[model samples]
Target: VESLSFFPAIWKGITETADALRLTVTGLSTLFKGVDLKETVSGPARIADMLGTTAVQSFSESFRTGIINMFSFLAYISISLFIMNLLPVPILDGGLILFALIELVTRKKIPPKVLYYIQFIGLAFIIALFCIGFSGDVAYFFNNFRGIQK
Candidate 1:
């Protein structure tokens, strides 16, 4: 009976995690397949702001509610990072996997110089993404600041 009691909780957690993964994948696909970049992409600052807001709202309700909300959000974030790490960007795990696949298919080791250039391009892409996200964060805060002044 004691063992049976925890089964439902475990099952629910597994199902919820799977659901979150599915949703994240779908969202990423939509974003990549021509969704409006500005509305979808947000920087670390924006994400932190959102997390702070969530924490406040959750704690305002009750201790148990707050704890649950924080855990759930953290789980979602972990899953997101896992999925993002699998994206085929040269600096990420997916890029490594992609390189391995290429080597397997061609049966030749990629040259060092080529690898350097590929990694450099990936770095540039990452920097560009950060710039875009940071700009968006700045605009968001600026607008909010103006609204408060009025």
Candidate 2:
């Protein structure tokens, strides 16, 4: 009975975390499908700016609201990152899982040279994504700044 007391809260957290993961997956799929890449994709700078804006607005409303909102936002970001890190890209955890699975099935290890090249490709892909996100952030800020000037 004592241990069961925390079940409801634990369940709620699990559900909410799953929801965040789903949202992150959906967002990534949408972006990859090129539905609104330029408008939706954001880099670290853009995310920070948005976070700051949200914090200001929420705190202006109420301290409690601000705290809740900030924590929620952080959780969402954390979940998104977790999902992304699990993607089957060579440099990430998912890539490691993929390699392990392949080795398990084939009963052999992947060559070091092959792994190196694959990781290089993954690095390139990550760099490309970073560039895209950074460019989007620059464009977003520039447009907003221009709007302010006008």
Candidate 3:
């Protein structure tokens, strides 16, 4: 059966998604102007390490402390997901938004040829960022182990 709640629920999701995108865009703008881009972007490995650290801490702490640690970690993961999904690199929510915005302002759809080129560029950019972040994660891990070995 149809329900009014469905529309409101959709709107709520859209609203939260937009707010998350706005937050991420604000952070990126800081990077565009040379505000320590290296520290802003994080890779999958870095995220995994963070969760692993939290998991270890939870196990070693009191039940109350463990719960707090886990909940905080989960919150961080959720926010990360919200931001990541909105990134405007091809095949992502942000890319879709960008295309829609352009169509809205131009009052015409972009040609498939031009869109194809734009998408490829976005994809390349995303891959490059991933490579950089992955390397950073590797270095971070290496430094950690080196300290322990020494």
Candidate 4:
């Protein structure tokens, strides 16, 4: 992104991003339906395990396919990251953007006290989410482990 200073570079990026977003949205549309959401939103451990399994399977198919598969997985992950960062949480880039938009429209700087509270809320929400994801991951791992032991 830093290297893309001019029009062509920026335009290409925008277009490619649109395509990636479309692909990602299409793939994950069901996740947003509020059905079995805990199972849907995987944590870091599950994500890593899935990726490792994919890489191994792809490599089993052949070296070229493995490379292509890894790149495709990365593209999807990149799209997910982009979308996640844009979620309107106060600690994320989206929150900063929201403040900027507000300042633009209101022609007044947001109160420092309000910003502090908002950030605190965001921090709390983030921590809660991390705890949930971590707990889910641990449960998932133990479940798999138990099945193996049986």
In terms of TM-score, the best-performing candidate is 2
Q: Which ten residues in a row are the worst by lDDT in model 4?
A: 1-10
Clashing pairs in 3: none
Worst lDDT run of 10 residues, candidate 2, spans 1-10
Model 3 spans with C-alpha error above 4 angstroms = 1-30, 33-39
Best by lDDT: 2
**After best superposition, candidate 4 residue 49: deviation in angstroms?**
0.2
Q: Score every model by TM-score.
A: 0.90, 0.91, 0.70, 0.80
Give the per-residue Cα lDDT of candidate 2 at 64: 82
Q: Local distance difference test, per candidate?
A: 0.87, 0.89, 0.76, 0.83
Q: Order the candidate numbers by lDDT, best to worst.
A: 2, 1, 4, 3
Root-mean-square deviation of Cα positions for candidate 3 versus the true structure, in angstroms: 7.2
TM-score of 2: 0.91
Alpha-carbon lDDT of model 4: 0.83
Would you list the rank order by TM-score, best first?
Answer: 2, 1, 4, 3
Candidate 2 deviant stretches above 4 angstroms: 1-7
Overall local distance difference test of candidate 3? 0.76
